[model samples]
Target: MKTKRGKIPGFAIQEMMVVLAITAIVVGMAFSVLNLVQRQMGSIEDIYEVKLEANKLRQSLWIDFNRYSYVNFDERKGQLYFSNELEEKNYTIIEDMIFTEKDTFNVQLEHKAFYFKNHEKKIGEIDAIELKTSKESGHQQIFVFKDNAPATYINHKP
Candidate 1:
């Protein structure tokens, strides 16, 4: 084969270094973006978990509240009571009505406030009850109940 002299072609050391630097910058950016996405996804999952727990708690409250004729809360004892009638009953309301995977989620029914303020009376005839849960954050939610028709009239505070 006849050898022919030609100008050296392809990338120089400086060119290679520039390429390497560009590649490193791109990889670093990609890694940072990936990390951010993962963190956001994790936060979303936590929020979903909290919402699911709140829904379950709300459903349980609706079931118990409907079954019993009256709901009462004793602040001093931090206990909730449910009775079929004003006098007595076979089944009573239980304390700590809400449940969550996390032990810190606190659930309480304010029966005393409702009773004293006459909120139950506002419910009127007890046709049906609606439960709604709102997310406070990734770890918490506020559950609210609306009564369709309550039997008695009671006073309430703003």
Candidate 2:
């Protein structure tokens, strides 16, 4: 008696097409996920840059606002000039870049302005002063200074 050998099986064209289609689907899904992650990372980076720059501006301004005897702003020059009895310094913006006397950073600020409130309606009786930014208006809230303050408005410079 002789024993019969089993035949080697091979995949048909339809079976091969099915495998290829499945592979394509998996690879396509992977690529889509990768692309989404990259986009998210870029967005996160942009937001972080904006925040970092804004913080720098706020910190520098806080110091200047406290120390200076006077404060002023120049819209065309994009400068916040601060002054004392002896010296004058400034924080200027150029080409979306902010520059202090010693440090500089890039930001997306669109506007600079000063607001004064005169509830008493008397000459040299300004009760409040506000330094505002356009892009992130929350950076500077309305600051109420004391009445009869010697810090008189002098053309937007401090």
Candidate 3:
């Protein structure tokens, strides 16, 4: 008696291995993209926090500066004092005097030892004041505030 033979045409072991390898590659690529997105989200959050803090500081400074007649930087006390007139106000205008007690933001006056004979512009008449803050040795931001306006120009140079 003659018996009929049939051939199976399904995927072999090698083909299954190849398909698994391709799937692994695709999954790895997907994970890599997910990681990149997460990192970017973290960076954006950090940037937003920094910007918010800067805005708050700038507003506080402008208000205090405008309310008082003069700003005196006391290096010994590590504080800034604003008074209606020198030796007139009994209270010293430090950070805690006007705003919240938290000391996250501190302002220090930089006085150039050499006098600029040509620089006769008064504080209000001056175009702008350059303020700088640093997060680290290499990371810093330079902000420019108009003398009479509340607008601020932020320059982030890292």
Give the top-scoring candidate (lDDT): 2
**Tens-place lDDT digits, model 2, residues 1-158:** 89788887999999999999999999999999999999999988877776776666666666666677665555566666677788888777675677876887665444433544433321222233443444542343324343223436444332
Q: Model 3, which residues run further than 4 Å from truth?
A: 1-9, 83-103, 106-130, 135-158
Instruction: Compute each candidate's TM-score over C-alphas.
Output: 0.53, 0.58, 0.50
Worst 10 residues of 2 by lDDT: 119-128
lDDT of 2: 0.60
Q: What is the C-alpha lDDT of each candidate?
A: 0.49, 0.60, 0.46
Q: Better model by TM-score, 2 or 3? A: 2
Residue ranges of candidate 2 with Cα displaced over 4 Å: 1-4, 69-78, 83-88, 93-95, 108-110, 115-158
Worst 10 residues of 3 by lDDT: 109-118
